[model samples]
Target: MEAAMSTPGRGLTWSLRGRGPADVPVVADPGPWPPDSGGPAATGRGVRVCVVDSGVERDHPAVGRVDGSWVVVKDPDTGETSVRPTETGDSCGHGTACAGIVRRTAPECELHSVRVLGERFSGTGDVLLAGLRWAVEQGFDLVNLSLSTTRDRFARELHELADQAYFARTVIVASAHNTPVESFPWRFASVISVGSHQEDDPGLHLYNPSPPVEFFAPGQNVPVPWLGGATIRTTGNSFATPYITGLCARLLSAHPSMTAFQLKNALYLSAANVRFRSLPSLPAGEASDESSESDEPGELHRSRESPEPPEPRLAAGADGTGN
Candidate 1:
C-alpha cells in the first residue's frame, strides 16, 4: 500500500511510500477526482464542452447526442465570414474524434460543435478566430482546440483571443504540434497546452517545465472514432488535446464556481510524476486570487545544481487532414 502525507509549511508537500518516485516529498495531486476513480464524475451534469474543430458528427455512436452546432462560413466573393447555426455533422471526422473523447471522459456534459476546418482540414486564421471568439462569448465552460495556425501574422490576434477566453473563465485546452514548427494559441500561456505521451491509460498525464507544451497525455497510436461511424488508430497532438479537454470538463463540473486560474492549479497539482524543481512557490494568501499566475513558472521552489535549458520545439497544424 502507498502512503501519502502533506507538510503545512511554505507550500503543500507530499511523501509517498512505495516504488513510485522514491520517498522524496512531492506536490499533492489536486485533481477533482480521487486517485482511485472507478467511475465517471457525476458532477458533469450541466457543464458544456465545446469542440472548435472540423465540425463533429453529433449522431455518431461515439459522439452520442450534441446540444448545438455552428459552422464558420466564408463569402467566397468578398472573403467575409460569419458563424451560422448548422446541422450537427463532421467534415472529415477529426472534430468527431475529439468530441467522442470528451464524451467518453465526461458523458453527462452537454456537447457543442463549432466547425472551423473544412474537408481538407485547412482554413484561414480569420475563420478559426471567429469560431473561438464566438465560443468564448457564449460562455462555454470548456473549449477544445485540437488545431492551431503556423502563421506568425495571426499571433497578436490569437494572443488577444486567448487572453479573452482566460479572463472570461472559459478554459481553452489546446494541443502542441507533433513536428518542429511554430504555431499560435497553443503556445500562449493563457491556454492549457497538451502534448502526446506514450501511455496506454487515458487518465495518465504529466507536467513539463518546458514552455509552449505544458502537459502530456496519451496520444500514440491510440484508437479514436473517425468518419462515417468508423474507428481508426491515429497519432498526433490533435487526439491528445481532447483527453485534457474531457478532464477539464470533469473538473469544472465538480467545481462549478472555479475560475480558469483555479482549474489550472488543480491540473498542475494533480499531474502525474510532477517535478517541483522548476515550479515556483505560491506566496501566502495568494493561492485563492488572480495573482496566483505566478505559481506557474514563477520563482524556483528549491535550490538547483544546474537547470537544463528548455529545448525549442516546432508547432504543427492539427487540421486532421493527415499528410
Candidate 2:
C-alpha cells in the first residue's frame, strides 16, 4: 500500500520568499509574564494541541509537557496492538521536527501525542482516519497533521473532519506536502495549509510561492530532537505547518472569544510582504509589475476589474478587522 503512494520530497518552494538561516525564533525570552513590549508571547498557555503523526518523545527538552497520548498501529498477523513506546514511534523524524516548531511558538500549549505513523513513516488510510476520530473525541483546541497520502477519498474524509473541528472550535493545521506536484488534504480548502519559507530572504518574504498558503514559517535547516539517540537538522513544509498551528493556539488563547474565521483573517493581514525586484521569472511576454503603491493605514484600495467581498460586520467577540 505504501508503494502506491508518492514519496515526500524536500525543499518545496513556498509562496512567500525569504532568504536566511533556518533557525525558528522561540517565544520564551524575558520573563514569565507577558512583556509590555510588542513581541511573540506565550499565548497558548492554556490550550491543548493534539499532534497526529508519529509518536513524540515525552522527555525531549523542547517538549515541556505531555497531557495525553495514544498509539494506533496494529499488528499484521493477529490484528493486535503493534504500537508500543519501544516499537512503533517516530523513527522518520518528520513528526518530531514539526512538533518542535509548534512548541517553539506556543510553549505553554500542552501536547497530545497521537501516533498514527509507525517505524517506517507509512500507514494505511484507516490508521489516519482512526487517529483523527480519536483527536476529535478528545476535544483538542488544535490538531497538527504533518503526514500526507494521495488517496482522494481519504482526503475528503479528512476535510469533513476539519469542518467538524472548526465548528467545534478546534483548529486543524496540516503540511502542504513537499512534492514535485501538489498533494491532497493540504490542497483541500478546509484545512489550514502551511508552506515552508527560508527565513531572512528578502525577496520571497511578502508574497506567496504557492496557493492556499495561509501563512509562512521557518522550515529550512531547523534543528529538532529525533527518535533514538540523536538530533538532526531538517527542512520542508511539513516542519512549517506546526509553527502556524502553535501560533493559532497563542492567538486563540489571547482572544478566546474569536471564531476560527476571524483567527484565519488576522494571520493573513499580519503577514509582511517583502518587495520583490521582479515578478518571479514568468513565461515569455507576461507583463507584471514589481512595485506596489504604498497606502496609508486604514486606506482601502480596489481594482476596477471586479468587486471585492463585502466587509464582515464586526461582532461583539470578533477581533479588529483588516485589509
Best by lDDT: 1
lDDT of 2 by residue, 1-323 (tens): 23213443434333335754454443422221223544334357678898888777766676656666678766666654443333344546666666776786777778887888763434467677777767876788888988777776687677777777777777778777777564556666567777778884311212254567566766787677776635787888777778778767776655554556765654544344422122244568966545333333333443222111122221111111111
User: TM-scores, in order shown?
Assistant: 0.72, 0.66
- For 16-94, candidate 1 gives per-residue lDDT tens digits of 4354655555553233333245423443567898999989886788888899999988777787778999985887888
Look at candidate 1 and give me any clashing residue pairs.
180-314, 181-314, 181-315
**Alpha-carbon RMSD, candidate 1:** 15.2
Q: Pick the candidate with the highest TM-score.
A: 1
Q: How does candidate 1 score on lDDT?
A: 0.74
- The 10 consecutive residues of candidate 2 with the worst lDDT sum are 314-323
TM-score of decoy 2 = 0.66
Runs in model 1 with CA error above 4 Å?
A: 1-43, 119-122, 275-323
The TM-score of candidate 1 is: 0.72
Model 1 weakest 10-residue run by lDDT: 312-321
